[model samples]
Target: MEVLSLIAGGVTTAVQPINLMLIVLGVTVGLFIGAMPGLGSVNGVAILLPVTFLVPPTSAIIFLAAIYYGAMYGGAISSVALGIPGASTAVATTFDGRPLALQGRASLALVTAALASFVGGTVATVFFSLFAPLLAEVALSFGPPEIFALMLLAFATFVGLGGDDIPKTIFSICFGLVLATVGFDTISGEPRLVLFDIQGFLRGIGFIVLAIGVYGIGEMLWTIEQTRGDVTTTNPKMTVKGLISDSKEAVRRGWKGTWIGSVLGFFVGVLPAAGATPGSLMAYGVAKMTSRTPEEYGKGSPDGVAAPEAANNSASTGSMLPMLTLGIPGSPTTAILLGGMVMWGLTPGPRLFIDESEFVWGLIGSFYISNVAAVVINLAFIPLFVWMLRMPFTILAPLIFVLSIIGGFAASRSMHDLWLIVIFGISAFFMRKFDYPLAPAVLAIVLGPIAEPTLRQSLLLSSGDPTIFFTRPIAAPIMVIALILIFLPALKLLRRKRQVTQD
Candidate 1:
């Protein structure tokens, strides 16, 4: 009942004139951004984060959350129309969405995606409202040792479940941690790792600088390379009666997968480093594996399209759970949001619910508003987005390039950051080319500062006894689990090798 009242208050706050306006505007911008191939919520948020400085922190977060919600809905548009995923999280959507388009059911696939997304997001938000406060209460008891153990668990998830090259992922994380140590020593108050004695290094490498470089400029470059070949799109036409029939058909065929994804996605997404992409893929696999007609999945089935589309949106909302309650990011996009919160002079974790009660609840409230706005706007504007896809990437690339530069400059007002953006962009291109996962690196940089302090504090409290991490009641099981997850891949590899030897 107490939680419900706070949520009601949040909804009241979100419906204020300026807040509502920003929600609609943010959703509109995000819809277009997500419909473009290679541009996802992460890119849209990173490139536009500096612009949020114009608004109050509460409204700024609302706007960004709306963009995130809208992006999840829009990614399916490209999958249905162009036979290509608008973002990596939507890749599963393409399996059935493209087939549906090829069979002239593109409008149906898209409508199903929109409807499933709505259901998934609303369900996840209800779960969030119910569970977040309880989690926050548990987190309030945490001290340095417990917090450090949680941080270890967070990185461990990347090693166990990141679905990337293990060596390269470790390397990326180490590189980001090294960067996080550059500016100064927090405890000692001394200059540290100032490369080449460059004055700019004293300020540290900002996460925003790296994020914009990787997602904004580097991703744009990668897309240009990928799209060198001509893309043939399916022409989808929708009418009022057609939409009505498609909606009914979508509900009848996709209801099961929608429920499955809404539940499954939220749990997966709450695990740090296991964001929407894996959640969607997992949902698709589960939905097909359990289906009566499994063979129908890859052949224009509405269930197939609905499962992934719903899971991705559900996971996007789910990713916010840890970020709000525990100060850990559950996804790459949330990592960036975490940094933005710190930049705004706000701390995450349980105390944030106390220190910034209005800000916290208001952002939570905007989730409902954003989800509803995203579905309505998405359904109404499908034809418009499909038409916009006809616009050339050759033209879009230059605009993103300019925006990335401007955003990079806007954050620090530094020529130094601009050069760093170019360097990181080129570096990110090579990293992606070599199949290195960048999310772990981004996450490491964001968590490194917080993790380092807690580790040092824990060590001091224990008189240099590393066993303190395992001795605490709350930290012990978490530490044990983290160690197991970290070594899981290596254990699997060794078992495989021994089996091969016996064979």
Candidate 2:
């Protein structure tokens, strides 16, 4: 009943002409960013943050969130049409999406991705509307110990969920933790990681630079490796008949994937560091293991495309959980929003719901509107998007690279960011070849900073008693849940190995 009222109020606020227009505008821009390789939600939102200064806070946030979802839909197109994933979370989409495109079913792949995204996002958004307030209440009651435990859980979940080389993922996460230390020591006011002259480094590596490097530059390198083959030239014509066939196919193959992605995405999004990549990868892996036609995977199976796309989109909603409830960002893009929220003098977290009910609910309502708009827009634009494929990558590459540099520098107007973009571009290229996941790295960087401070505060308050983390009821249970989540994957892998050995 409480949730229904909030939803009612949210709809009312969202229905205002100005807000409605913003939703359409936000989705339109987000779609373009998602199509443009290497841009990602983090870079896209960061680039647009300055524009928000001239707009209302709620409107600005609504616009940025719309972009985030739009890009998600756009990424499917890139993966299916160009064989290049627009973001790390879409990596799994490449497994089957590109294959379908290669087989002259690109339109089917795109339509399926968009529709699945819509369903996953819509379901997750409804769940979010109902659950966020309840979760916020729980979060508001949390003390430092509980917060610390939750942060630990987030860290563990990401490390465990990431299917990449575990050691490298750990190294990247730890590197982020180190980078987090570059700023002032929260307790001592001491400059720890700064090499004595650069105050900007004292602010730590900006999220914008990291995103552009890992996503933008890294994407460029990945694209460069693929010998420019005859770009999936055949148009898999999408007609009303084709649409019906694809929708039926989506329902047939995507039901489980949708649920898996939605549920997993919700849990991961609640964690401060888990983010979308883990959700997408885990969904893909689970779908493959569960499928009756496992052999068809990675060879144009619609289920393969459906699963990851669902997970990635669902995870985008999930990523909002911690951001809204605990004031901790579950992803880099959320972190950027956190900064924007602070700048707007509006605190995020449990209190926001109580004090800014309309704003909070309006944002939630916009998710539904933007998602519907995304499907309608993409369906109409499929032919145009397909036509973009015929344009040469050689021309697109430099344009993308230049935009990345601009977006990076634009984040804070620091020239150092330009250098960071170049360096990250090189690093992202290598990481791609090495099979590393940048999402985990970025999530770690963003949340690691918040976690470390919380941990320190908890420890100090407890007089260095680590048991305080487990003694608190709410915090302890969350920690335990996280522990189970972390160990379950490993246990499953071990069981599979044992079964193989016995066979």
Candidate 3:
């Protein structure tokens, strides 16, 4: 009851004209930035963090929080419209979002993403308000071994992202893992796989580079080759009735995934370093894994679109809990927010709730408001986004090319990355032609950096005994489940072979 009273008071604080105005402004700015390739919530929050200084600290965090919330929603827009994930968090969204777009169901995909995001954000905020302190302790429980086990679980779930070709999926994941190891050794800090002694390899391959190359350029190439310049998506109608129907269909089809992602994403996001990207990916994998119609997952399934969209937004909210209560940032954006809090003469930790109750509650209250604001603003812009889809293939191909090149360069400002993007793009086109799933590769590169360090740290903690993963109370179950998931596809494949032989 006391917490409810605080939340009510916090809501009142967030409703003040200044805060509400900032909420809308921040969400709008974030929406567009997140829609841009190579830019995500980190870029949006960092770019505008300077502006927050002019306001009071409470208002500043709310503004940045609004942008963070909006960006989560915005990230799905590019995934659906351009076939490129607007943020790493949205990579799973592309698994179905892009397919929906190609099928002229972009409207349905966008609507599902928006609704799922709202639901997920609302659910995570409720969790945040109810169990902030307890969850922070749970986050603290994750040591290197536990974290590595969790990463193992993530890789196991990753198989769900690929086609039924088990060996091909394994190959794709291995390829990605190798690419993930191209940079310096996580502990030794020495270059390990610098091909041709290129100094740029030290920087390693950015996920955005691979994502843009594979989804953006490679998709473009595949489209041109397939259609031979005769591609056209149905011009989506954006009337009020159309939106209502899409909303209903989204709920009918995607509700299960929305709930799954909201719960799972929040849980994952509550971990100290596990952020929205993995949360979204894992959510997508689970949704597909659990579906009776698993084969429908990558082919414009509304549930598939909903899972990742919901998870990313929920995880973004859940990430704030550790930052507010434990002085640990659950995500990259929250890390910046933590820094901003310190700059404003406030400390995050056990005392934060008692000493800075108003600030903490105000931010949480703003989460409720910003979710409403983002969905409403995003819905209003649906027509504009869909309009882009109507463009002829000739015009759209060049646009994709320019955005891919610009996004790669802007993220790192490296000519080497630029060249790699081009090379990867062409390579992706070939991979596509061969029917190898690129999703596993993308997931690997994203998780590899995090996985490598934790695995190495876990091994060191156990004196190089691999049994550490199976001995720790928390790690053991996760490792067991991960191992099962890794073998599940192969088991199914072998069973099918046996049946065929008997026939």
**Please, what are the lDDT tens digits per residue for candidate 2 over residues 45-128?**
898999888878888888888889988888787677665566667767877887787676777788778877888798788878
lDDT of each: 0.79, 0.74, 0.89
Ordered by lDDT, highest first, the candidates read 3, 1, 2
TM-scores, all candidates, are 0.62, 0.70, 0.97
By TM-score: ranked, best first: 3, 2, 1
For residues 1-503, could you state the per-residue lDDT of candidate 1 as single tens digits?
99999999999889999999999999989988887655678888888899888888899889888988888888898667654455667767876886786566777788899999999898888888888766444535677887678667767766765557999989988887788888999999999999999999999987667766776666556656765634333344566777788899999999888887888777666655556766676677668757898778768889999988889898888889889878988676788888888888899987898899899889989999998899889889866644544446555456557766775676567999899889888888888888887756665676677678989999999999999998889889989987987898899999999999999
Candidate 1: residue 145 Cα off by (Å)? 3.0
Considering every candidate listed, which one attains the maximal lDDT?
A: 3
Query: Which residue pairs in candidate 2 collide?
Result: 269-318
Q: Name the regions of candidate 1 deviating beyond 4 angstroms.
A: 1-134, 223-370, 378-388
- Candidate 3, residues 337-414: lDDT per residue as tens digits? 999999999999999999999999999899999999999999988878888889987888798889888988899899
What RMSD value applies to candidate 3? Answer: 1.4
Q: Which segments of candidate 3 are over 4 A away from where they belong?
A: 497-503
